[model samples]
Target chain A: MIGYLDFVIALALAGAMAVMLTRLCLGPSLYDRILAVNSFGTKTVLFLSVFAIMVGRADGVDIALLYALINFIATIAILKFFRYRSLDVALSQMTKRIDQVEGGQ
Target chain B: MANLDLTQYLDYALIAMLVVVGIAIIRMKNLFAIVMLTGTYSLLSAAWFVSLDAVDVAFTEAAVGAGISTVLMLGAMLLTARDCKPEGKARHIVALLVVVITGAALLYALGDMPIYGDPNSPVNAYVGMDYVAMTPNDINVPNIVTAVLASYRGFDTLGETFVVFTAGLGVALLLGLGGRKEEEN
Candidate 1:
């Protein structure tokens, strides 16, 4: 049942996806960008699933599931990185103080 | 494509919602607002899939788009800065140019595509139909989505999972612990 309506829907999703792109450009925090990217991933899963339907296949659902799993893992990794980065920054500041005291001697 | 009298009406509504929700997600300044909108966008998209008569696809979209993506977004937020850095003029110019070019390119590509659900398109006549028709017999999963994901496309899914795992591991390894204190350094 291909129709003009489906095309409009697809394009609209594409437009919505474009909004996510805006977040990549204007996201207030780095985390926001990551969230936006994850949103994009979910949209992609939806898009592929729709395309699968468009092609009359059951395979798109399968891909979407895989994508969901992937998106979660990615978020986990990014958080992990952020946690470490902050700790490192703290350590560096302390080291600088120690070095200054020692160098004065 | 299967013969739903209400499908057209639903499809149009769904697409409209998708566009509106997407705009809201992008324009809202609050991080939480964006997250909620994104979820809504996914849910709306899943509903759109259902209207397309791809029940399996619809189910998958509902699960991943509605459920899992939000959880990930929340997790990432804990460590990330609360707000984005203000944009510079140079960056804004670059972003506008990129969006305009990419949008133009995509619109051009759309013209060559087959009409939505055209049976003669290679997508319909290709191996996808074979998977849908025969997957039930070989894999016996009533959910063709599952059958293809776990069976025919199992290997690819595995690779994708590995990528996710790697992303997590990298974040943990690189961002989690890589920042050494001065003492450690």
Candidate 2:
């Protein structure tokens, strides 16, 4: 019974991933693609967890945990790169630059 | 039995998704979108690897492919044009012909391969079975994967770590080791 539920969950996640892929490919705006990619990564994490349960292996959950952490870091890095246009910029400098712009306004 | 069939279907669906993502990545003009799609592609591959019971490979793919590669590509994108220049149809046709030939050759080779999970397969019948049997007695590690990587294959893992260290050193040197900044007093 539990295995059947896991199977259904896995199938649903796969379907959702297909939809996300479609959104990614047809997306006109860059943000759409970024969101789709991040969402897909999230789904992958969930799918890995479900698959691990289905297969009766506990190792898949560990990988899923790692994936979730990496996915977040990657998303943040991408967003930061887009915002600052440079990854090497110091956070202090970024905050000061933002302050200066806000002060001028 | 029923659940096994469902998992198999999931595997096929994931593979189909991978193919579609690969085609989309090749056809896309926007560099940023392409990078994102590549991340999606990597995540899909990681999921597929998990389904195949290759949790360790899936972990590496998730970390390197989905995480590090995406950030690296985004960094590289900063130095390049937003949109890729359109290529000629002739080039596409030539590339397609090469891909078709290589794929055909691989498919032909696949026919000679042993069935998946066959205990009689050459790979499963050899040293691998020995390791599986010996791990509990010799290494006493609960997870055979960890035991094999850290103990039996320790030298190979050490070499891989050394290679990674060298790559990190090279990157640091190239970037002037400026990963962090010291605040002015």
lDDT of each: 0.61, 0.80
**CA lDDT, candidate 1, residue A49:** 62
Q: Best DockQ goes to which candidate?
A: 2
* Candidate 1 DockQ, CA atoms: 0.07
Write down the TM-score of every candidate. 0.50, 0.87
lDDT of 2 by residue, A1-105 (tens): 348888888899999999999999998777777788889888888888888888788888999998898788678777677666666655445553321111100
Cα misplacement distance, residue A21 of candidate 2 (Å): 1.3
Which CAPRI tier for candidate 2?
medium
Local accuracy of candidate 2 as per-residue lDDT tens digits, B1-185: 66667789999999999999999988887788888888888888988888887776786677778877877887898798888898899999999999999999999999999998798998899999999999999999999988988899999878757654654443343233344575542
lDDT of 1: 0.61
The count of residue-pair clashes in candidate 2 stands at 0
